[model samples]
Target: MSYAYPRSTGASSLPSYTSVPSSKTTSESWHDLPNVAKQWMVEGAAVFQTARSQDRHDIRRFASLIFRRTFTIPSALILLWLFTLWRGERTVFQESIDACAWENWEKWPQGATPHRVAFIADPQLVDPHTYPGRPWPLSTLTVDYTDQYLRRSFSSIQNALIPDSVLFLGDLFDGGREWATSTTTSPEERYQKYTDSFWKKEYGRFMKIFLDPWMDQNELPIDGRGRRLIASLPGNHDLGFGHGIQEPVRDRFQAYFGQSNRVDVIGNHTFVSLDTVSLSAMDQVDPQTGGTSSVVNEAYPDPIWKQTNDFLNKMTYHRGRAEMGELRMMQNRSEGIQFDYRIVEPADSAIYSNDQDEPVDLPTILLTHVPLFRKPATPCGPLRERYPPSSTTEELEEDEPNSLSISGGYQYQNVLTPKISTEVVTKSGPNVVQVYSGDDHDYCELIHREFNGSPREITVKSLSWAMGVRHPGFLMTSLWNPINPETGESLQQGSSPTIQNHLCILPDQLGIFIHYGCILGLSILVLLLRSSFHVFFASEPALSNQSPVLPLSERRGDSYKHQYQTSGTSSSTLAPNGLASRASITAFPRYPVTKASHDAYRNLDQDDLVTTTSKDKGGYRPARPRGFRQKSVLMGREFVHSVRVVALVVLTVYFFLIWRW
Candidate 1:
């Protein structure tokens, strides 16, 4: 027999068919109703009677089933849509260990051409604060999260089209001092502690996590023979506390990676890696049990404030027509310390045996940790008196004499003067000597004044390390053959003419496009997915109190069947008014279901239901069996609606994986 859902009336809600007064009905005519309709009525009647009986368990089950059929699929579809958008936009970064292959070297420009050198300074590998076994009290300079920044910078450099050699200038470690003792510990223990604690622990772990994989996948090599190769020069910290002394630190460095200072001839170029740190060491003294000290502190007796004042006075007045006399006098008097300015000329007789011992005449390059000059002469004005007299004086006095100013101040005389000798090599023709130094943890390029005349023309370029301050990124240099002047042929060692200044062109468009597109796309995808899920699940109203507002066609057949009961005697057929009423009700207008109406039904109480039915004709209806065919049809519709949602969840997961990669 066909079943129908219960309907609401003005007086009291119509009892379900099951609850209707049952007298033995023998009317064959009533059975003429469609089986689907008959079945619906029976299910609805059962639910209505159970609900009327105040059976909490049955009512709860019916409510839950309806809520699931109504809301679950729609929610799933929304989630799926959000996931798709997320997946489409996400960027997937692939990690590879061996990116640089031997075959990639074939792309390098042919012939022995003077290459551009990029100097990276002051990487400061270990973060002192987190480092194990570090001495108590750390410097104010807190380490930034530089490891990630350097890895990305390296990726950028690798993606760039230019071929280059990298020179790492000094301070490769935060401080060379360590806890391993040679006398008390075994040699292996000492080595293990040194490598594990310093290199493998802090910086090495970072490399393994992010950088090494990048380099391997990109095919960039670190060896000398590899394209875009790298090498290093010792800085003050790299040398530990020893200046001129060949301490254990120096020996350990040599043991690990050959000599600390060496000169390499690449093509027609001479790359001189000087131990600028050693020069500073010559003036340093061991603060703990001070002997004659490793390096002499010439400015020891004189306060730094007074010395800086005198130096500023010389620079301000020596070449200027302007009277900086008042400025110099004010600087001296500003700090009550007496000034004893020593004209600390280079210990030339001691540093170099002969006055005219000229540096090698090849196209030379100098690599050191500190800049040669304190400040380049600026046209706007010399920085000689740039700092207000009081601040400058106080800062200088606070700094140690032999130590190079980590931030603002001047290099010691020893560090400055030796570099001047190196600059002289740049002056000779067809020769361009570029000085590459690190220790500043930033990228900059400066030129020798006499060689190219202007900063733009000068060959010098400075680079910050992959370990220190993170922004602006790491720099790479490429050296290649210069085209011939006369024949337009690249100069060969034997047959071709020498050319000057091989230009470093930036990377091609394809590399840049791929790198940036992936990064931006992935970021957008992640954001969209997160927002969609939040909007749908977090903001939606509850579903239970809401009513299913069906069309008149749906309501009439079910409602009429539920209200009527069969009354009969055997073998007789009779027509009933119920059929006519069902027909008429089916003809009524239909209204669309809304979220607000649905919420109202979901929150309806038994008492509210009684009131609502009396007030609104469409407000109440008998529930159907939890597993009725009508319920099954609703569930099928829900399943169809939820396909989009299921798909979206899958896509979101996929995109999340892509982002991780």
Candidate 2:
């Protein structure tokens, strides 16, 4: 005898299956169904029925089955690894770096290697003390998370690009200048507090975030020498801009991050890092006198402005000396004379070369915190955002105010004054190929018409997500000026180095959060639905009020197996409806059978016996009402589903926390 599923007879509305032909075997009947029907059969029977069920599967059995299936197919493990480890912080950061392709330094002339510098700007690490109105815990979390982000960014840069150097255009701390300036007590005590707070407390955080041990600066080589970390320019946030600058804050920042004004020579190029913030203060009206102080006048003594002016004068002298030395070396090389490689310019030597009345354009890269002066309506390039001009001009007129109005409040200035900017460009030398600055906290690229050569200036975007812009980014630059290996002089005179700049933008963190939030919500909903698949057959409307006929012996035995011994009958014969006399009729376990129903069924007429059961005779029972036990089972199922959903959420959070790790 073969067993097959029965056709649906109108009593069930949940779902119906077509009956398998009784003449065919179970496997043969299933194989005979059309492919399209087969697909519908699996979907309708398995998925729909499971989804429609009101009861849950047994927890232990379900978990065991899943555990076994995992060994055969590791898709669950693979998905977990994909979401957690593969697509994490390193990948996100490296992908952004990759998007901005590096200039092919390998293809350049062999003698002088090109210098690759990664520019990081305006990290402006959040300090909780800066905002008193916010909750302390939230502020702490913001600080921690920002630090982690920077750590990952720095780590990824070290691993992926491995630049010859990393330049930190300032705004290193949000509260660096504010620390000791607050008036709470005597100057001595306040100064001590500032030292303890900044050097002792915040210093650790700064080092941990930006200077991971693995990112040892010396690991990368430039022109056969170790690399350098240039953090010269002090930000307004670090030492306060213009007249608001405090001596103590300036001293501490200089002590830690190096002098605000300095020069670095690498790979036949000059990097002039100027303290424009201090220089802008030179013309402010003196409180002692009604007249403004002049930076050019040697006797006009305002100590802060005086120091920066003296530095500029000294740099101008150095630029003149370097130019004269290089010119003399070039002349000597032509005549085939062995000249001293050590460059020294005597006081009598001419600063100007005989070839041109205009000063020779030097290959220099100027780094500053405040950008050089520009008109308010000047159009920053395509990547510029936040109040961009409606239309753009390719060039700004030279006669227009080469200076922006020196308007500023507490700790910042909009731009350097025209006089200070001119001083910087002149002292920085005639051919400043590029100028990089930060403080606007967004991307801006425009030509400085006042600077010799009208070189491009890029105001790098901030690295912190907390900064107002939607996309935060950094700049990658490659400077290649090939030089003779023996003399260390430029092989091509009168030409500036090949400087290429590319901006690599980071992923939008807000958008990432929204994406993860959607995934979390959808996951919980799917898990809840999956937990409802165990009671479909029992809960069906057709099965609820109807009594299914069962063979007498099997009904009495309450088992799958049976023998024909009904009411002492001896003959074993077919039941005439093509069923074995002793064969069993299937009934759901949910409908219980009792001894009293046997006698009730025996007395009923044949037609009524199978189709209907009298309530008074008690042959067939309706599905039992949901009780305390059934409700408890449902509660347990809900609890398990909740647990699975919570696990997914926790995993997501954990992935973020250990992303860099």
Off by over 4 Å in 2: 1-64, 67-90, 101-112, 129-132, 181-195, 213-218, 287-291, 295-302, 320-361, 385-407, 484-489, 493-497, 528-640, 644-660
The digit string of per-residue lDDT tens for model 2 on 1-661 reads 9535444322232244644445657657666656656655645676666755523556666887777656421234335434744454446766776776564333455565677788999998887435645696888877776777677667667776787778889888876766763332113343344543554467677877877633564465554435777776789877777667777767777887788777666555677888877777776765545556673445544456767778777775555445445545544543222333655556434343333322234588888899888877566656765545443564443222322234677657878877778888877876788899999888888887766789788999899877887678898887787655444456676654477787878866656656667765665555444333332223322222222244334334333332222223223345678554433333444311223233433333333313233344333333222344453355345545445545765667566656636
Deviation (Å) of 486 in candidate 2: 7.7
For each candidate, what is the lDDT?
A: 0.39, 0.63
RMSD per prediction, one decimal?
Answer: 20.9, 14.6
Which candidate wins on TM-score? 2
lDDT of 1 by residue, 200-236 (tens): 3553543453346345544433323334344345555
